[model samples]
Target: MNPSASKIQNPETTVPKTPQMNERDFINDQLTTEKYMTNSYNIALNEASNQALYQDLATIFKETQDCQRNLYNLMFKNGWYAVEQAEQTKVQQTYQQFTGYKSQLPYSVQ
Candidate 1:
């Protein structure tokens, strides 16, 4: 086997050769790629629709969160009210003990 032929067959020893290509084909492919890619992909979406959808979703989420907060507030408020009521009841009992309801002398004294 010839050493020169063996060297040509080896990729490491061989020089890289440029292939012949058509300029028109290259330009066409570049133009096609540019046409497919756009600056804003979501430009097709309507502004009105986007706004309405976002508002609707935001309203639903806000309502759900507000409902949870209101429930917590109501629960705490009721607990506080119960405590206040119990304190008032204790005060009332003490007052009743001091100024006990009188039978007076009874109907016979009247």
Candidate 2:
């Protein structure tokens, strides 16, 4: 781990390590499924030609995305998921680097 990067997480809630799947394992599996569903839905939405089909998929996509976020939150709350806090200087540098590419785009960026 980088010295400047700190973990944003709660204390881990203990889980069983038996042959059977535990709560964390089930949630993690669901979270992974939701992520895959969302990605597939996005691609489908992009290629969908019929308006009705597109609308249906769009709704499902939104729901899947929300579920994915909820699962992530649950995992984070239980310390099953941990995110690294980006150093402000590194974040600023990345922002600047991406922003510098705005001028290279054909259309004007606001």
For candidate 2, give the lDDT: 0.96
Candidate number with greatest lDDT: 2
Cα lDDT, model 1, residue 84 = 22
lDDT of each: 0.43, 0.96
Q: For model 2, how does the per-residue alpha-carbon lDDT over 1-110 read when each residue is reduced to its tens digit?
A: 99868989899999999999999999999999999999999999999999999999999999999999999999999999998999999999999998988767878553
Measured by TM-score, the strongest candidate is: 2
lDDT of residue 4 for candidate 2: 67
Candidate 1 per-residue lDDT over residues 1-110, each given as its tens digit: 32333121212222224474444344345444433432122232223367777576556555545554554344344331122233555679988775554444466745
**What's the TM-score of every candidate structure?**
0.24, 0.93
